[model samples]
Target: MKCLPSSLLILAVFPLVVVAKRRRVPFMNCPSTKSSSGLGMVKQARSRIECSVICLNNPECLSASYCKSSDGYTCQLSQMFLAGGCSGLPANGDCTQTFVVYPCENGGTFFHENRTCHCVDGFIGDYCHRRYRDCQETPLGNVLYTIQPFRSDYTFQWKCGPFTSPYTRVSEYASVFNFNYTLTWEQMKQGITPHPGFYFTGPETLHQLTKQGVYDLFIRMIVLGKNSGYVIYKHFRVDSEAEGYACHWKSFTRYYEVPYNSDEYLDGLGALGDSTKSMKGARFGTFDNDVSECAGTHNFAWWYNPLGCTLVTFDPDGLNWPTNRTGTVEIEKIDHTLIGLRNVYWYVEDDLIL
Candidate 1:
């Protein structure tokens, strides 16, 4: 035997080298676990890539099966290649479906069993490159109250939560009533104005009071995105005449400067200017004079006096009297307290009302 030429020897060695190099095929099915007639044996690998690396490094490994494990992945090195077909190995209860590991583009994971790429949370699209916002319920502001003489109202503002967008359709219902009457569900539905309920299109919204009464308000928000929105409820009370003052005269009096039966008096014993009196009336015994002096002497005095036949005269000097009659009348003032709200109810949807 004689040695071959250098060029021919190099060509022969190149084919052998090519045959020894490992081939990687994505989504190829293989035995998920170690079996007698399937993959020869199982060895631990840190990840799916490590499993493929294990097969590439082994001269006898014609194919590989990668299954997720607590430590990482279990690499089943097979001596046979099924060419993207299912393995005939007995199914292992603890093993995941087997397939060839491939690179997942854009921070995604290629699921060997499913042969699909799965993006992490907050990401979407074919390559997991697009960021997506999750839908959420908007938060409601504090309820504000407005009072009137015969009615009152309330208001609130709200907007979509973080990474969420408002939907077109929104619904609201309120159950309003007082101690004397209750606003029925049908009445509430009738109160919803402008058709199709409180549908809104915006990132933020303000809910104004259309009706006046003490009631509970329920708002249901529908949002579209990665998540569904939520329903919120609030209670409010409005009252008229919740505060004011009540007043009346305690005591009043009138006085005369001239003597009784004086000729200078026009309509009475004294001129109107010369006479002084309380707007209301004087207290008993506030003035001086005898009861007999007033009897039949003056008809106005006889009928107008609180004492009647026992009438008393005005102060003689017009400066002092039996009682302090120069002071202003004292009044008793008070504030009105609000009444407790009764029979409160909240309805999220029309059918929920009762």
Candidate 2:
């Protein structure tokens, strides 16, 4: 593991990335005295103009009605109008009134010039109804997990995806310990290994081991920038020192022989030995010796291979897993400086021991 250049002068200044302006949609007038159903009280406004502005900001508000009575001006916002049914009496006398609604689809309040929907956090689509991929399904359906918001107190806000939840206040830790971004194995052993609270094992109440006969867990981190990533050790368990774990990399070299018959002499031979040639009956283990050791060890262990474990990158679009590129993932000061990460999720895929 080589350290990044210490002289890597932190460029304090960088060009600001320009964001495109979003288009605003005009509000339509609804019939006076007629207010839609499902009118949840958002707030009180002094005038009709103030009422309309409130309705426009609320994505769920489909229409707003303003009424001028002896008491004063009153505004009412509704979510379900097309469903039909007026709540209040028709306006009359000097009580002049007006109503307005915006044309938005699938609970989307923000409209862009491109005619696309600016969905609320946790949703995306032309109508802003579809859940973001990360939130749609558990990373590994087979693995149990939990999701929580990652909070940072830096001066700048993290550029989390729209789907991510708002940051929550949390106790600050050492600068060297950050699970928000990708970390190397060495970094994990040093930083996170000491902090058990940051990660979660499956079913805290359940004492049973994973179906694979090992402890499987889930963790999240902040993705600093493009091409930058992290590696998590499998078969994680607490030890005197949080070290000695491996990634279950996929490779043919990892395949080895297992004895089909318990009575066979080859059963005593470890997978690494050449006892397979003379054995009359044997079965090849799905994974190599390293994987077996890591899985079987009572102490903390993990399966790791340079070839099979792929590095993934998280960008504004979404997760970008291993491509044709090959090399150890690199983290630069600029990587964290240029772009703030929103969040990253990892699912442990442990092989079932049959």
TM-score of each: 0.18, 0.23
Q: Which sections of candidate 1 miss by over 4 Å? A: 1-39, 68-72, 96-354
After superposition, candidate 2 runs with Cα above 4 Å error: 1-25, 31-44, 53-63, 70-72, 76-342, 345-354
Output the worst ten-in-a-row residue range by lDDT, candidate 2. 5-14
Across 102-135, the per-residue lDDT of candidate 2 in tens digits comes to: 2234566533222234544443433443332222
Candidate 1 structure quality by residue, lDDT tens digits, 234-340:
24321111111101132212223232211211111111212342212221111132123342243211112233322222221111001111342211111111111
Tell me the alpha-carbon RMSD of every candidate: 32.1, 21.1
lDDT of candidate model 1 versus the reference: 0.29
In the predicted model 2, the residue pairs found to clash are: 122-163, 180-221, 180-222, 181-222, 246-302, 246-303, 247-303, 247-304, 248-303, 254-288
